[model samples]
Target: MYFSQNAIILVMLMFVVSAVFYSTINYQTKAVEDEIKIKEVSIYEKNVKNTIDRNINKIVEDAFVNASYKIMKSRKFFPNAKVAVNYITSFIKNETNKSLKCIVGNSSNITFDVGSFDIEPTDDPLKIRVIGNIELRYTERLNNGEIVGLKNIQIDKEVKLSRIPDPYVYLNKFYYKWEYGRKIILNNFPNDDKNHTFCIILNDSNFNYNRMYNENSPTEIRIIGRNSSTGRWNVVLPYWVQTWREGNNHVSIIWVKVNNKELLNVSEDYIYLLYNSTTPVDREDPENTFILFDNFDYFDPDKWNESGEILINNSKLTVVAGAGSSVFSKDTYGEGYELMFRANFSYTPENNSESAGLFNKLDDTGGYGWAYYGDGDFEIVMGDDSYGIDNTFDYINKTYIYDLILNNISNHPYIEYNIYDSTLNLEYSKRETGSFDGTYPISINALPPENKTSNTNITVDWIFLKDVNNITATVGAENIQPITYTEEKPKTFNGVIYYGVGAYDKVYNGTYSIIGLFTNKSDYWKYPTTVGYKPLIEEN
Candidate 1:
């Protein structure tokens, strides 16, 4: 009986232990299943958010493309500003609807808010801005019945509208007086109230050595003075009327009439007349400024002083120089001036010992200039000193455009030089700051190596010089189209357009996105007049 009872207790304990073990296993299994369900839901939500963000971005991009296309198209076809703006706005609205419909699929709840469009006008191009938002509603809903969606994705963008024959205006303060008379007077001067000066540029095709200096030749040109009153003309020869003669047939003269002289500004009412004895007047400027442009179409002997052995043919100036030879300009330059020319050499030297190039500030003593060596090197020289040596260039038989600028307005005057190789599309530039005394003139020099070729030939296409400060007008269009009726006309027009978008939930809770206001600029010129018009001519 006692053994039987012990066996029974052992069996009962085993049963209770089995029950506890089964219950613990079931609880662990349930907990694991619940955790897996939560993870699946979280991943699903993340995927939905990513899909919505991508779709929103695509919609914004499509809208921007559509608007830009319409705007550019309108500008091309329409000449009037208001008409173009209206057409573009309407087209964009229509296109935006179509683009959004295609992007969002067949969803009735998807909507777009196009914000205000902004447009501003300038002289050449129009600036435009666009802002807006997109709202997407999905059929799937959250536990609280909120629609799965993206709301108020904003877009802010800008673009420019360009036009052909852009609007511009030019002012004319320089002119040539060509009417013949014993007393030459420039009437109806522009900007008369401002302090003015006059420069008379004389060019005689038939001028000779005897006619330039002698008082007997009928072709001899002379400037006596100004008529203070109607009955009285004064014979005051200003000290600045200097003449420089090249060869025998051409004579170039420069005369300056300043405002401080009593003979010139006797009274603002009376016109200042120049008395010419014989030679026909070539050109005259009310402002004492001149542009020196030469293409060597025919050798204008009055323009340049040739040195060494120089040849002018086929619209080129070729200088053949030995060890020490140079060609200098007969005319002098001062203050704000820009000099541009093109040059090339026939051959390259084997060593850096030989040099040839352009020089300025040249006098009887020495000068500052730039030199190109036969060994593919370039140098800048001031007086007897040299700086900025670059030997890595390959300038053999290559044409290079040289642009030099002298700025003398500040206490420290500086020179800027730019060399452009149009053939190879390479550029090298240098700037030097120093004190420069505005005297002497410009020249071209070449030095050949000893025991080498006796002469090194340098060819120049053309040279141009102009006053930097006297840019009275600009030819802003091709074929010399008229841009403005008068100098006072407006050159640019500006305007703005606005765009906005809003999104709302079922309970009226909503968010708004705005493509904020932007501006566009349109530039235009007025109809041109003949009074101050000058054609920009290129010499071949």
Candidate 2:
């Protein structure tokens, strides 16, 4: 009985030990499997996280590049920070949706969200910083189970604006905020003259200068000469413009004093002009504002228009009229001009009904003039009749000087005529006519008592409109050729003209001077690109 009981106890003990061993093996196997599963999930999560990070970087980088190009293409430089940041952020989201597939180890179940963007200023003047948030969600299926991964990464990038243009860099190259520019070449310039006052006439025949100035506002025109020694473009100031009319064949007469030592050594240089809302430089009282000066050495079609028989001899313009004839100035005068005529009578009027003399205002409707009648009398005449007669004066063949001045004092405009004998140097007559508010051409006319009967003639020695300042200065004509000489027909000149618009913006609004290497025919102009900017070539 004791042996049997001991055997039973041993069996039971062995059974209990086997059960414990099996339990231990099962527990070990499960622990090892769980560890392997954990490692697999960790590896998959790491791969997805790395992929999301790489894609986020790529998307951000590409957005910056694309935004830069967009800004350049649009020519909207110096945009506000908000605008720039929005551009980058919007591009990134749109591009990611279109392309940018984030996959890790053939796992296609991955998605990302790009959150808001923040922009900050950098130490460099031309650089900016951008920060973005990316939320990535990844799901993958493994042999043991499924793995779900979530990551939130913040991306901070510094964008260098090296590709954009620096406005200050380009503005420093020019003397003014000139809107237009062109190249001019100097040839046959007098080398002997050290200081020359060049008279540059901007006319329709030479260039379309009417388009150069701002009609609605005051215009400041300038000539820029490049310095040979300093290798910099220098501004030429104290320049004068006698006439600047914006009409057909009208002129803008500019006189510039250039120092030979300071002028550009190269054959070509640039001329710049500006339009600003501010008042232009006062050139009215300057010595260089000569309205007109002509010696009549030769017949210049550009200066005079003659009708009937006319002859040029001994520096004289002689007009003979059997019935009626006239010589008139091509340019008409408005309110602020003075006409000086020097002439002698070639043939006095034959009778009381005949007349010959100078006219200050001439048009289709009878003009105001000083006439010598056939009765040895001088008269201030209107059209064919005498208004004010000077019968005491004797009419003879002698040189005489006449002046017609338009006075614009106190807003009341009137015409005054003064007659003097050149030989005696004494004033003969002075008269003030009624106020006339119109433009008229200067003319010399001769009228006979009857058609094709009386011999009426006059010879003009010289005629010129007096300079406004009334001071005489030596004028330089070294490189100025008024019109092409008869010998040099069809010879084109070597200068270009451009008028710019930014002067107004600079003067009135404090805008930066634009970089202009462009030629535009339209009044509107686009800004050009520079250092951190890009420019599209503006076609002429």
Candidate 3:
């Protein structure tokens, strides 16, 4: 019985050992299978994640393109259209979801968030731009704190919009005026604003010309003035006018008269003059008949106001002055005059103490003068102080002809000082515009300081004063030209008028408004639109 029991125990122990080994092998096989299954699951998740990422990226790119097209189309229709971020995001989602739903098969897998978007007009008035940032999130659900697939797709986009040319009209007008002998007049002769009847009254009766007047058929009238003297019926036009002829013997007066004054009440509108002259007028002649010419042959006290030591030798007038000595003309010349002289300094000081040049409009206390200083500089002086500097030429013991023109005839008065070389070629010229405060007594002075170290001397070769006759025409100002008038031919005034029509967004009111207005025209018309005039507005 003990042997049988021991055999049973040994078999039982062997069976237990076999059962434990089989359990260990089964557990090891199961561990390896679990590892392979986990690896397979990981690979599958990676593929799904890659696909999701690609789909998400594609969706973002498509969304950006579609959004850009939408914004560009919208801006073409409405140039100043304001698109919100929510609207853009909604548009992108609607467009992308259509394709994304087919790819991903789940609406929850594809999602979008637009961070920012804006549409604004650029500096180019015809163009606008759209700029924004967007993010697309693609995700697939997995168990227990693990994400099988996830992708955050980002996109940045910019879009520029353009459009066709807008419609506009160009508008302008032509103005015409008649200038006659320092006077300007509008074309309405019978009903002029000044209400003066212009006529060419006979003065000497020496020359023969025709004077025809017909009250009923009065489109134009021609009258002749004799002897070139002041006639009885002399009228001055409102603006400055100039008319020139080669010889001042014969004068022709032409006038324009409307047949019906009531119908053509607008004088400043469309009246043009046709000038047909057989002889071209010489307008550059000096006006005054008398000219002051002196060669410094003799010292004439009747012509000059002399102070200090003045010497006249070898046909040259020399003035030696200490601190406060000057010599000027006794008679005063009017405006529109030029004073010219050739001068040389005996000695120019190294220090800035001496000055010598032409002084005009002089008095005891102060005067306006153009001077050359000791130190290579030219200056325009008002009394003791300098007003402007013209450093064109440095006067150092040289002879130069100086011409100073004072023009007070125009509405804008100006003074021009010119220096010429020894050959009378113009070297330097400076002009200034201002109100001159002195009368026209011309002088030549050698000025020195209070504590003068040396006496200043100036030698003048000759002095000449002449009157300037012609008026200089400035740009954009009234220019006068002489023209003959005939009954058969009349001048035509033609011009183009521009108008602009624009559609602008009333952003505050959320509506659009159309603006139509006239743009450019000549200075004749007072108002753009008349009492019953209406502009034709065509929409295209």
Candidate 4:
């Protein structure tokens, strides 16, 4: 019985040992399985989070790029609108690597100044405090707040966005609220201001300027253009907007450039002469020999229209054959007719050697085939049948320049002088080469002037000469007799008078002194330093 009991005990002990070992192995395997599952779940969650972050970053980068483009290169064309918004949104949602987000809308409650806003008058723009509401929209939130995806993951960063402020609802009122599709520039352009007080009207290209101005300075108008058939520019009352056309190139104010560089009229684009304006304030009456021509009655040898013979002045008129008298047309055949006066001369001499009858089938050059008589640079006038021999003299009508036709006679000479004092000297020349005739050229010099030009004020054009009697300075004034030459030369003549310096801008008045002598049809002018003095203007 003792042996049987021992055996049972031993078997029981083995069973307990085996049971403990199996339980230990099973527990280890279960623990290992749980650790493997935990690791796998952790990896999956990490991957998903990283992907979401990357996508967000990519969107932000795209939005930033679009916003940047708008501010830099595309604002002028597609400023703000659907296109811009779509561009920003698309970039934010589709861009890779960088995460971005953006929104666009308007806020009427926002207020901004002028310069910053691209505003037009149609907006009913308010002035002063420029009251309005502005809308703020999200534009971009870049990846990691970094420029591109080249860098390591960046942390959360705030993105910059545009905001609109309100101005109208009292200084402290919160009535100014922003919403989408509404934008108000509150002091937008900080330093800019909108001014539309005074109005400037521009005339149309087809407008008329005939009654624009009448001898008076335009008061109410700022500027004006003159009426011309073509290429005409004038200053008249009220500005002309005629130069501008609808949908044409941009127009300009102040000055018009001829070829895009050469500045033309300062105000008006054209200027015309008032041919029939009142006679000058100064000048002697004509002998009433001129007859006005109705048509452009311009022809050679028909100069009676522009001029006539004066029979009864103090002296008769005469000319030397060698001297050149430039006449538009002469009535040698008794048919007088002529055109408007530019300038010219006429003469009849007592001596045949000093005079020659001029006849031209056609018009001739200025210094060619002409007759002349008078003092230096003598301008001619008209009357009738006063050519006297022995007592015959070349009579000059007492008159002044700038007088509308001295007489109705359009037959007189017309000399539209084109001269220049280029060398700062008195030397001047007129060559027949300007026309078909290359012969017969002349050079007249500026005589020594006693009086110099004045810089203190506007220049005065007239000066009274001494001893120049019957020389009316104006409508009613008698001139003193001019100094006479003691001796007359047959083939020589001297021009110009010398006297004491008078007030600046006026003709010198005093005793005659220095003189210049030259042969008829001569090419050179003598400025004798011994007595001839050349006057020069004061340097600016």
Candidate 5:
């Protein structure tokens, strides 16, 4: 195989060129394979990132829906902005944690940790913005290798809540604008004039009269009228009782007078009977206190006892005579009292025994009293002794005032009767010397001429009795308690006070008891607009 020097060199050069060519081809092929590996790794990373981004958004949406449901079902008032925001933030955090388990893309190696949320109020009073930071640790195993990393994702969202109602409106659309502590709202009164004087009935059990009637609060209780003209609350006067009972809910009639220039619209405007004092109020109408005084405005079972066809009609106590009707007071009055009443007859009676007038008794079966008979005779019975006076005036089909005074003079009780026509002109007067004993329960009766067959009846308009022991001066109330001008902090729920919206104000019904009237139907708090939820990405 030996050859010349030139040939040998040529052969060596050829071998070297072949080796270099093969090495270059191998290097180029390795570079191309590395590029393909890099592209695959990049694509896998991008896909994983996209999956996490999509899952994060879905989690936020689900959490928002869950929070909104919880909020709607929670029938509670948000006392202030801080309370509301905290409540909402807590709800969102809880819901997000639950929804974290639903993230897709990785079956087992997926880990999503939802962190604390920051809730902020937007310019729109109805909308609230929520920002959440989530830590995602995802491990993706591929044929090539395993891709492991942690991602911090920030989600920004806005939610709307408008289903809640304002609490202040439930407090009569005015939350202690005039006074605080205890308040009784009165509406549904007749509002035909600018000045209104009317009576309101309240449950005694609901009011703290001890706190209301204190000297420090003498004027502490005020009748604040909602002035429609000024859209403000004005203190009119202190309200007092025309008739009040000490026992629980025993015909407590408080009379209020609002003398504002603007006509009080009872249907639209409410009168706030505010009380926030701890001082005792002096008795201004002590003399006006009566043993019994009823105008028959409403039938109060606590005040009267009736037998047969006795009922109240048009504010009058009507006693039909078909079955021997009678109405008596549940309360009794003592001697030294003036008993006066106004009465009228349905038809004339035909017998002297059939009569209608006032009666007082120490017992149920027998008593001493007086009456005007259908036979045109006025009779008076003392003990068992009875006397009759021939009818000197028309006493049928018309109204008359019968005033009877029973007092002790020189330690001897006497009975004096004065009868007047409807016009208040005296028609008959009488005085009888006698000795009466014991307290008496007053009554009005109608004895049918035929017992159970007569159609004639009697109607008593009103009955009034002075002090149990004696007659006193007339009662006139111009002012009740003095008004206390003091500023006090309003009551709050959970240390936060809530303002009111006019739309949630309830219609005031004077007929309801104080407990029923002040029912807070608007306990559920709400936003001003409709609910909305949208998630938008934000930096940081």
Candidate 6:
């Protein structure tokens, strides 16, 4: 409004100020607009990136799931394909987010199916399945601070479940009892379930179902809840008979029996006391209460050791023929006794014509004599050493020989026991006296060396020799001479000695009947047949 000389200059300056203000405002507005545009681009780019990532995740998950399904179904991971795919999807699937299928696809591609077996298509585990308890357990803890275990588990619905027999071993009635031998203590098992086990007894077995049982011989046994994440429910079956083995187990002892022959003497201490018609038929001597022992039938262990505590040890019976010195408990009777000692064979001389049984004439205390009883006949004569006996006492001059039935008993070849019937029959042979030096406590008249052949099997049977001074040739846990019997007369065991007939094979050592019967002139046993299983006395 002022128009002086100063006013003119002020006015010009005001005009210039106005123009500069206008330019400044315009540039500021443009710059603000550009910043807004840049912000919009940034927002758009972020949205695009997020969408891409989400889509990628979805694809991966779907692929993972599809691959998992194929793997499970085709391989029949579960009982069948139905269970396989269903199980995998249940863990990895998301219905509301079907787009999330790629998660499973990715997971499947990462995992490996190892040790898989053949597949079946028809089975459906869930159709009649029982879902198992979600047992959260420690499967494994990797060093990388990761814990893995079974999850979402379910017990199959169709699995058959049954109770197992009480794994208890007591004094079996027919094996060892108060009246027969002694009350024995057997091990009891399957009684402790602290480990948590569920059993499924199978009513169907390949063998006779009626004979197959628990420790008591149940008809079946199977698995239950075996899919446990822990080791509690899974187990491998065992091979057991009526025998109690030591730490080595029943299976190991079977092999020992096959290798050794001299195991006969040591076998009775800890026997395989069992009865199975299929493979094993060893039972305890059941019948008792008699002094004569006419019947060896036994069942329960309590009947034998009515007062004593009998323990069954399953230690392996490894008896070698030459484990010890051939001359056990024998002292040389000066220089003469030295001549009687021979490893393989020995020579004996004859003495009196009739007074002696064609052997040397030694005094009652000097000569070795045996108490023989057969066909109700009784006599005394010199003991002969021809069988596998090691004549370590060859230094003692053994005179005249008394022969006993040294072959198999009719059909059983594995059994060549000394028959007492004809053993000390002094009248039949060329009697002799004053031969044996009595260095050995027990008179061992072994079979001749020439007679011993791998073809000839040897069996050892035992009985109470029925005399204060009489003892069976073989000594075992179950076989002992009765020092004092409630009733006077002792028990006698009449084992036979015969060989196998050459009709079937050259050597006969035991009973050879596929069907289980008694008929034939063969006095020995043959291959592939269970012999020495029964006593010489038949049970009527």
The best candidate by TM-score is 5
Q: Which lDDT tens digits does candidate 3 get at residues 128-201? A: 23444434444445575533333344433333223222221212121222232111223323333322221121
Tell me the tens digit of each residue's lDDT in model 4 across 321-365.
Answer: 222221222222111111121112332222111111122321121
- lDDT of model number 6: 0.24
Q: lDDT per residue, candidate 1, 1-540, as tens digits?
A: 999999999999999999999999999997886576455444434443454444434433344444444444444323443544444455555555555555446545444444434333222112344444434333344587854444444545554432212111111122222122222233333333333333333334322233232333323233334443543434333323323442243444443332222234433322222322222333333123335666667666676776556777899877665544556777776556766667775565654222332344212124455665556565665556666556446554677777666766445577776776532123877777765555546676655565444466678786666543321211111111111111122222242121211111111111111111011223122111101111111000
Q: Which runs of model 1 end up more than 4 angstroms from their true locations?
A: 1-290, 322-324, 350-366, 389-392, 421-426, 450-453, 469-540
TM-score computed on alpha carbons, candidate 2: 0.33
**Highest lDDT: which candidate?**
5
Residue range with the least summed lDDT across 10 consecutive positions in model 3: 512-521
Better of 1 and 6 by TM-score: 1
Candidate 1 vs. true structure, TM-score? 0.33
Give the local distance difference test score of model 4: 0.23
Order the candidate numbers by lDDT, best to worst. Answer: 5, 2, 1, 3, 6, 4
**Residue runs of model 6 more than 4 Å from their true location after superposition:** 1-276, 281-326, 330-440, 443-540
TM-score of predicted structure 4 = 0.21
**lDDT assessment of candidate 2:** 0.49
448, model 3: CA deviation in Å? 3.5
Q: Per-residue lDDT for 75 in model 2? A: 43
Question: 1-540 in candidate 6: lDDT tens per residue?
Answer: 455888889889999999999999999997996677455444433433343344433332343345334433454223333343344334332321333232223432122111111111112211111222222122233488754432222222232211111101010111211111111111211122222111111112212222332333321221111223442322212221112221222111110111011111222311121112121223222122111111113212332211111112232111111211111112222112111111111222221111111122211222333321111122334344322222223212222223322112223222111221112223232223223323432222222123221111111121111101111111112212111111111112122212112112321223332101122212221233333222221211
The C-alpha local distance difference test score for the whole of candidate 1 amounts to 0.44
What is the overall TM-score of model 6 with all chains considered together?
Answer: 0.18
Candidate 5 local lDDT, 1-540, one digit each (tens): 456787999999999999999999999997997576555445444544465455544443444344333433453434444454455567667766655544433546556667888755444433446687777665667799997767677767765434333222223322222224433333443334434344455444455454443422334445555556766555454344544443334434454555434334443444455554432333233123344667788876787777767778898987766657667778765566777678775445455233332355212123456655555655665555557755634666677777777766448777777777543457877777775655556777766654355565668787766522321111122223322333333333442222222222222221111111112322212332322211110000
For model 6, give the 10-residue run with minimal summed lDDT.
164-173
Alpha-carbon lDDT, every model: 0.44, 0.49, 0.43, 0.23, 0.51, 0.24
